[model samples]
Target: MTVILEATERRILQNPLENPEVLIRIVDDNQATCKSLQFFLEALGYEVRIWNDPELFLKEYKENEEDGCLLLDIRMPRISGLELHDILIKENFRLPIIFLTGHGDVEMAVDSVKKGAFNFLLKPSNEKKLTETIEAAVKLSIENHLKENNKTIYREVFDSLTPREKEVVRLVAQGKLNKVIAADLNITEKTVQQHRSVACHKLSVRNVAELVEFLKVLEG
Candidate 1:
């Protein structure tokens, strides 16, 4: 199917704010379809990268580094798109994934969506809908990337705490009072207060609720 974009339509989809620091990664065994999607997306000013083989795509893909949503064909040679999505999930990849599927593969696409795929585009997708979906997916990919980066920084800060501070943070996050923590760790309340104060400063949290939220984000 030929995809035509009117000048106004192009303008609507070509907002720079919507253009994130992300490329469109396309993995499809069908050369013609790949070329069509690439052309359509690139015409709308998106940076696109294509791979004809799922294995090659997997080898090249890195979590949070490549930083883009995936456009994958649901049925492929060795590793199916669903299988690839599973592998990415197992490896803790948080980028949005958009699957390309035929009518027969709708069930698999639905299953992938349930497993956190961004969305699936039917073969011979509508030009308007495809571009809109890709834009939304790119925005989501950027948000996910920011979240993963934030998590990394938080984990680093959490790791920088001394063992004693770590214990204090753990107990505090578990809703233990400083006196209870001191008793549990066989320390005076004054020592526990000192440790807790330092931990709070290091973690940059003013209160126990904030510290617990940080811990939750770090763990996630």
Candidate 2:
């Protein structure tokens, strides 16, 4: 229900490009618990935002530009944490999620993890465990963000290639030699080689191995 910014004034003044922001969003119905966590996590230097209403959080939460993670309570009034997690998954939300579960909710929490929630924290969690889990989730969020960004860049570059260039790249990815590709396309081997060179240059790939790896990532 509250967004706490307890970071020092000096920390706030620093260039975000140099010190990227790390956000921790908490969605729990209990106001007291939310405030307690907000104070604790903010002291640890995270930008914390809490919500008492699951529906409100769902309505307001968008894909974050900064590296971050979500701390969600397992049991709530309207939308349970598991249900929210499902919706996020269906929407392709990639922020790492750490579920806050009560003793009776442990089994459900485990199931949520299997379905792609990052991890779960038991209620009344110890400070050390909570901090460690949040740190790991933030790290993962950063890595995932970087990978998605790279994929976007790769897709843009790939789309820029001509149809013939794309066909040549696909053949090369299938381990075809220039002569074999030429025969398949009914083109000269020299023309096939030219397409290969152009594709590699456009993709910024130095060799076949690199090109293959790039294609693998793009396909994945």
Candidate 3:
């Protein structure tokens, strides 16, 4: 089966208000497919970085923490695409991921999304569709980086808390009441109350629920 991408179709997908950065990391075992897509993306004016192996890709990431989204192949030698995604997440690289796979790998592609892929496209996909998805992913990567930075800034509000208050916060997030927290920590109820008051004051949260909501953002 072939995906039709017409010559008249737009090569570019979206206009960037600010010049967007994209790093096309193609980790396909096949040289032809990798080169072909790299050519397509470069023709659209993106900075293309082709990789025939995952180790080289990981080495690049380890060296440079830069602005970009990954155009990843679903199946590759040495380190699989899904494995690379896991490694990136573990290393705190939140850039959006777009998986490319063949028709026979539909289930694997669907699983990739469940595991945090931005989107998956069929191999030999329509050129227009490919560019459109890549553009959306770059936009999403920018948004994700912004939100991650916001969370880092917000987390600083809680940094002045004592080690005990930190423990209290973790328990509060677990829905433990003050009395339960006291019993678990072997601390007096009054001390627990004092810690809660201080945490709320420093965090600028009117109540426990707001603090929980704030923590939820950090998890994302």
Candidate 4:
């Protein structure tokens, strides 16, 4: 078990998108099912958590938890997977979700995907399919987290700029030359150049291409 776990960890580390820190939350009423999945997923190097009660999971879930995906069983008691998914959406939850369903629930699973669930798997899910789907979902979760983090950083940095610096950055992103910006702003070319240089330095962008990219985060 130790050797297999170590090997899986190494394999996950080698993939750029896969991180051992990614948490996998499983919600199912069946104790046997939860135990089986916890063992399988942990062997693949994920941190696994299981809940036999959907309401308990909801009560304990933290909205701003670390990067991860939810492995939810669709036909749980008290609160169905689809109902929980709707609640999470209304709560602005961030983690990607993959639903586990039996063969008869295929249509419902498809509808969930249409409504923005990451994906779904039939019960007795094939090992290869489960691994691939989880990998993709976790990759998406990490990417989204990075994008939001970058947006926050960019917003703070942009807010720190002087008004003139912000203006110069906007014009530069619009592909205006320094002399044109100077003329438009009734300033000297040297002053425009200085503003551009200071702005670029503050934003840590090396060139116009990077500057444009930085501005895009702010715009978005």
- Pick the TM-score winner: 4
CA-lDDT, candidates in order: 0.79, 0.80, 0.73, 0.82
Residue 164 lDDT (model 1): 97
TM-score (C-alpha) between model 2 and the true structure = 0.82
Candidate 4 C-alpha lDDT tens digits along 16-88: 2465457889988888988999999889888889888999989888843867799888778889888999998
Candidate 2 per-residue lDDT over residues 51-129, each given as its tens digit: 8998998788884556788999978998988888898899888788998867436578668889998887788999999
> Stretches of candidate 1 above 4 Å error?
1-21, 29-32, 53-55, 62-64, 74-94, 102-105, 114-116
Q: Which residue pairs show collisions in model 1?
A: none
Model 1, poorest ten-residue lDDT window?
1-10
Off by over 4 Å in 3: 1-17, 150-220
Work out the TM-score per prediction: 0.73, 0.82, 0.58, 0.88
Across 1-220, the per-residue lDDT of candidate 3 in tens digits comes to 0011112112222343244455656677778988888788888877777778887888876554455678787678778878888898788767778888773377877777898888888777988898888878776665555566657866676677889998988788788999999999999989998998888777766766777876776566
Worst 10-residue lDDT window for candidate 3 reads 1-10
lDDT of 3: 0.73
